[model samples]
Target: MVRSLKNPKNAKRKSKGSKKEDGSSSSNSVPSMPAKVWQPGVDALEEGEELQCDPSAYNSLHAFHIGWPCLSFDVVRDSLGLVRTEFPHTIYCVTGTQANNAPNSIGIFKISNISGKRRELVPTKTSNADTDMESDSSDSDEDELDNEGPKAPVFQVRKVFHEGCVNRIRAMTQKPHICATWGDTGHVQIWDFASHLNALAEAESNISKDASTVSNQTPLVKFTGHKDEGYAIDWSALVPGRLVSGDCKNCIHLWEPSSDSTWNVDSKPFVGHTGSVEDLQWSPTEPYVFASCSVDKTIAIWDTRLGKSPAASIKAHSTDVNVISWNRLASCMLASGSDDGTFSIRDLRLLKEGDSVVAHFEYHKHPITSIEWSPHEASTLAVSSSDNQLTIWDLSLERDEEEEAEFKAKTQEEVHAPTDLPPQLLFVHQGQKDLKELHWHTQIPGMLISTAGDGFNILMPSNIETNLPPANATA
Candidate 1:
């Protein structure tokens, strides 16, 4: 079930200094609105507190669930321009299922007409029944208003049969129609999504038709070299069709495009990690250079020109590093998330000097599920944790005593950040349950699509300061 997004709204700070009726000067203190701060793992809910996402916080928000729960998904890069800022947006995504007692199939979903504010489906019951009644009536009117826009968003899916449950899915950045899937049964398979993409594109023009078009069980290429199944896989953005897949058995295989639609999988797997490889990422600038994090509590940077071992290995975290994202805009910065609810940003340039972790955070209460740097903003990034919070962070923001003092004077002691809260924490979004992954839309500046056990949330917060000066911006 999708819960109402719970958010704390900061009251707008009004201009200081107003004249009193007596023409005498009075302390220009700003009034503070009620502060609803819910630190995901830190704060517990009151007796009957329900999350109500402030609708004004989002430019677009929508949620929908597929029949089966999916653990991994990817946003399909389309022919559409790299930048799109228009109403009623359309997005394409591919995901696979982990069903308990049904056939597993990979699906391509076309989500369209996503333009509307979130409306409360169920009114929260309060102690005062009259207030609750008024809230219920207000929600009814708002629902009608929500419908006044260009119709509610829709999902059109086309499926292709697969043998075993899919562990993770990654669409090629250059050729989105071709995607690779890791299977639970010790195998990696590549599938062409040309047919699926065509069908979804056609469905968009005529959304009235509703049917599941299931294709035959076939993959473009298949490999069963790994002894154990795993989840580490990545498609190189620097190289057109170069791919890498790492398994639980400390092995990584490289896939190079040999033809228009086929890839040459090297049988000699690259091996270094003594434990399971949890994640892999190709460098944004170097075609042969990539990074991998493993359960051994370390991250390894590998170069294909070198032999089987990592070019350089670092003791990256205290526990298993579950995820990592190499900054595309700022190629020197690398971000990593660990199983112990901690994430760190490292400056790759400092590796030769010594340990290179420049910034670290332990704000998440649970293991981080995903972390990604914003494609548009060099100093901004977003992280999702199993604690059900997708937090956006701006590394450029720092604690300034003067700014803090001014903020306190404006809020009039009504609202203040907890001492433990970091100044970089820009926004906290909570609504979904068991959130697994999130990615910033390459085309939209602040737009993001997140997948969770309940369903998915497509959100673009209105508060992402567009004018925040970027550093080393060349994305």
Candidate 2:
């Protein structure tokens, strides 16, 4: 779902125009100012000197803001395969400006190469429009002429969706395009760079030479199945035009986009979770199956090919399950976190009719808010808690043969070990008075991003290092 972090200060002005006596005149006349375009990576920095920040100074602080009073950040690379300091390639923060009802106006900044200079990079507005156009055209021609390989990184701060305050934002893909999940007026909306005009110019340059496909400007699509607040959605990887969504009403609806310009409900309401389904994830390998975790203290697996009942149900927690994730690399693996101060991983293949448990984790003292599997490394899992710390686990280590034999022979009490070594803990920015949400960047595997309740600070993943090799090496 795509949502604009920028608040509309001119909403009243927009509303005022709607009240004009002559509707026809109002409709025909274009306003004096051009409509503000929604650009995701476009920066709002004030022009002039480059801004900088020190990563080491704040690295030890556990909690600190990179740019005071700025809202969003992202990370990207340049043509030489070098990480650019001026571009916030991974994270984004949304700080609402309180002036002129600009509760949604946001400042976008990026982490800098200089450790102490993680500041905002503002773009300048030039009156020489023709010159700029020529420059852009020349750049396009150069890109077209060169067949060196992958293109350089291009980043900008884009204003995606502007409505009410966005409660949650998740990326479905990465550039040459990106999609953001947004919650607005009890509906779920997905905004994509592919849907916007500003993105067309960028997309045209990025198309591969041997491709036969043409890009389409589909704008944004709104999914309104949830009568109340739609909480979560998972895009289908196997089936196109299909999505699974959960809402506050404890219902899960499967949707398919039909040829008639409307999304149709493909299945009946899949109901079983006693409370709100906070999250749902589709299995990367098993496209017909998916997992769902709810606030009702249960996790269930559903098969799209089957009927309404869950294929297998597990009452794996003592409290509300806040989040759930499927290991894209592991076909049968499922992870769920709960308010009971614990997280559990279950193997769908190991589930037996009377077995009450599979594998249990007790790491956090508070509810586990988010859990994700590392995209690059399958066995590595990242979990975040209300305690404001992120723990990374390496689950690749194999057990000793003797220990495995003993564990297989022992009872549940003897097999379960509570004193096992803790995962590597990386303390994220915690000093924020209120923490709202945390997410990992889909494109940049190791990058983590978080938002606070006041919408003040957005923190990027600590210890970020570029995987791109040095520029001088030939392909």
Best by lDDT: 1
lDDT of 2 by residue, 1-475 (tens): 1112230010111222232312233443434222221111232423321222212212111123322222222222212222323332323232222122333322222222111123112223334443233222112111332343222223223333244444444434223233334354565654444333233234424333222222333335666667666556676656655678887788898876678644677546888887888888888887688888887788888997888879987887888887888877676777778886688777777788565445677766776766777655566667756554455665654446675566445522232222244533322233333233455544443445454433322233333332433433311
Model 1, 101-171: lDDT tens digits are 78888988888766633322222333444433232221211134333334666678878887878888999
TM-score of 1: 0.83
What's the number of clashes in each of the models?
A: 0, 41
Which parts of model 1 are misplaced by more than 4 Å? 1-35, 116-147, 205-213, 401-419, 466-475
